[model samples]
Target: MYALENEGGIKKVKKLDQFLQDNLNDLRDRGLYNEIDPVEGPNGPVIKISGKELINLSSNNYLGLATNDHLKEIAKHAIDQYGVGAGAVRTINGTMDLHVKLEEKLAEFKGTEAAIAYQSGFNCNMAAISGVMDKNDAILSDELNHASIIDGIRLSKAKVIRYNHSDMDDLRAKAKEAAESGLYNKVMVITDGVFSMDGDLAELPEIVEIAKEFNLITYVDDAHGSGVMGKGAGTVKHFGLSKEIDFQIGTLSKAIGVVGGYVAGSKDLIDWLKVRSRPFLFSTALPPGDTAAITAAVQMIMDSTELHDQLWENGRYLKEGLLKLGFDIGKSETPITPCIIGEEKLTQQFSKRLREEGVYAKSIVFPTVPQGTGRVRNMPMATHTKEMLDQALAVYEKVGKELSIIN
Candidate 1:
């Protein structure tokens, strides 16, 4: 409890502000306070903020399509034709032609029989999980699955069993146990196509085999993998398991470079989701501009692999540069790189120092990861040039050595 200040013999402490301030101070003291740095313009490889330009490595704009001129033009055209808002929910009159086109394009892109669009990737997870799984079901999820997945599982009211991250044996054993228990009317296995934090890929082939052995539904949330994997189709296609997986979830926001999400699966599955998913039934639909832009972006991705190649090349360059500088760049199979720093405060400080030195990488600390394994995650994009990466590397070395994180 906080006491009133002596100077305010008149009881000067405002109760609401005092409570919030106290809580905020506690977060700061614990080194868990998040510092927001807003970008002034587009989320390109280099971003400007507060009159300073930085080599940005903190965005999910993996393909640089977020700022692509072509996508912008397409979006403007959509707005001209259909306006900004969708005008209603999907279950109502909001199923615009662009929305239908986007879903069709997504189905074709993902090689699924049909697809249904949602307002966001997070919404897709929430809707897809709850719409399919219920109290009679059990979900076997990866321990490192995204927050959206965890929330979706909770919303589903299904029994959630978290197996070890990327551990095939653990998953196999869990699936077997869950199947044998016979407590569930249906069992589903959900996982991220690519784990966002470590940038490691999920073992989809092994998971698919286990799912088949146990007669489980397989769902892949390829939010981070779209436009960055399988030459831009996604991780399911990357593993050549497109036909086998039951559900493929993706986002238009990430590599697609716009907004909204979708679930691509059998026509029956999508029809079920469209009717039963809460977001589609209750929430407003995705706007015409976003729907059209996403459709265009997916087409661009399916059309060529130039952006994909450049993204991987940039990832390799950043990793190699960090490794040569004696930074503990973790074993990331993708462009999502993390420089591990042990302590929470130190990791936050390292991120702050990087920003001060013209780089913008954010810190990922407890309990997002293990309490002690704090890190600064760097996401290199296809738009970044070699010179920009070189600049970022130099800044990293400076800050890392300043904090005694690297020799």
Candidate 2:
């Protein structure tokens, strides 16, 4: 039994408390517990935590627009005009002009006829997948799809068939099997345009061909790919399969350096989602400030490739430096580099040592990746200078040598 203290006295623990305590204790014991460090100021290439400044490589601010003066000014201007909140759910008068404009801009950005915005990328998946799919439908998901995709599929009550990650043959076989089964009414194929952990691009062209052969609906969550790939248009655009795909999901929080998610597709699809997607129907709309800022950020990406090119340049520099230092960066095709450490405890220790040496790359362990494939995922931003990258690489080299992770 455990005891807890309140304002007046101590009380015996409830069953819930015991369960929580047991699980948390187990996680700590096994080195699976994640300790979150709060940044003291703005989230940028360099950040301060616990009064120490560190070169930040864990943020998803790909193009570094999160702290861009222009975006900040836009957000501030929006806040001044719209005040603090949207006042109610979207269905109940919260769909302001800013929201509409953002959706329109998103559709234009994604090369779709229309789009619908959600509070977050995760929520977008939940609303979108469940809105269109049901128990009668079957979802063919990649084995390495994001957690949000998994939850969304679960919420839809669909029969999930996970194909091996990036294995086109496996995908084709499953697609054939599901299409011929006659057990489901709709079969949707879902994949992350860029797998977050491994930083690999999805085999969308092959997936599209398989989908065409099977008449399956294709859904690509390009959260990480948008603002970083396809010359800042995303993975679908990168492959020039924008018109061929069905649902294109993206997050404003990542490359756009704003907050929210959207599903860009045909006008009919957006109309259907607007009417049927529960999050769109029930949840409050994105704040006016964020909506306006997101639109501006999208426009910024569409306007120039300067930031995108710089980001790629920085990514290549970092990856090449790490490779030269003999670090095992797993099969990454994007800027997301994972320095694989193999064990959870050691991976966490490696991250801690990197922090102490003035870099802030976080360790991702089991449940996020696989048990033995733990890594410190490094996300290089457009704002990171050559100097910052060099500093981070030096720290990585020092830590790698000390931990005996690299020769």
Candidate 3:
């Protein structure tokens, strides 16, 4: 083993150590460096971070339900009945009745034949994509699919063909080529219902039409679209094409304000995942408290669109205010708005300035997005008041002017 103080009589570190240093250096050079700040309070539109109260614009708690009283009460009751941990994988002794109840609730919420739960939205991608496709199959994936989906596809041992983001012509060409090659046993076309980076929606209806033409198995990762779109169900419901899309993947972590993932599809697909998906088989099921909380969240989403409506109202108000303030709110239709800042350094500076002004917007730089496309990603929660939005807009205006990002 190499000694820390001296290695081969040299004071320098090894090549492996250089790798991390080099990567971090590159990040710093490009102004993409990230720093973790401790959140001192609950997750809401406004939170106390490092003792400063800032309007939180970086969280995925879309409906502000993460800290809801009702959900908390349900979780506490479940903990009393079922304890804290699952203790084993679902296939072993971890599958509780609560798990079944949540899965059933999800199916009802998604209006699908069946649904199976995983530990996260990321896990859902890994489990579903890898479970379905193998080395002999080919996957037609959107260029901007989530990192989890990319890793999942890599694990599948499938030939991945990247299509231009939401380009139906490109998707059709790739799908046709894959199908005509006949070298693969299955063809799966996957896309995100809402691109997280840009917030522009996927052309699902057109993609579905192309899927029909190419006999491709369709997959929609609605991680950012669910609960906000589809009338609080999902993008599939938004497009009125739920029956046409084969696999519907969503996150409970985001809109549901809980921790887990699920796949809504045909009963056969759910059955196959329950049996073969590595995450499903290897990981402990969600705890009873999370399961019960998730069930309440889903039922709340299904029964009333209050949260969804409020979220949209907040989104619109924020976007309009930013635009009026001469800030470039990018091509976003959903609550996931990004105020585009040209250079990565300035973007980071802008975010820092916003934080100093009591607004907790985070800067996203290259690698997470393309260079020269850095942004301050703001997700306005349903619980945000008009007063809060107005205050955030004022901060953005001040920061924008200070940085010369706006006149």
Best candidate according to lDDT: 2
Local accuracy of candidate 2 as per-residue lDDT tens digits, 1-407? 66777778867688798999999999998889999898999999999999999999999999999999998889899999997789888888998999889888988999999999999999999999999999999999999999999999999999999999999999999999999999999999999999999899999999999999999999999999999999999999999999998999999899999898999999999999989999998888898888888999999999999999999999999999999999889899999998989999999999999999999999999889988999999999999999999999999989999999998
Q: Candidate 3: lDDT of 13?
A: 62
- Residue-level lDDT of model 1, residues 1-407, one tens digit each, is 45566664755666877889999998799788887878899999989999999999999999999999999999999999999999999888998888888889999999999999988999999999999999999999999999999999999999999999999999999999999998999999999999888899999999999999999999999999999999999999999999999999998899998888889999999999988999889999999998888999999999999999999999999999999999887779989999989789999999989999999999998778887888999999999999999999999889888889989
- CA lDDT of 199 in candidate 3? 86
Candidate 2, lDDT over the whole model? 0.94
Candidate 3: segments with Cα more than 4 A from true spot = 1-12
Is 1 or 3 the stronger prediction by TM-score?
3
Better of 1 and 3 by lDDT: 1
Shift in Å, residue 80, candidate 2? 1.4
After TM-score superposition, the amount by which residue 180's alpha carbon in candidate 2 deviates from its true location, in angstroms, is 0.7
List residue ranges in candidate 1 displaced over 4 A. Answer: 1-19
TM-score of every prediction relative to native: 0.95, 0.97, 0.97
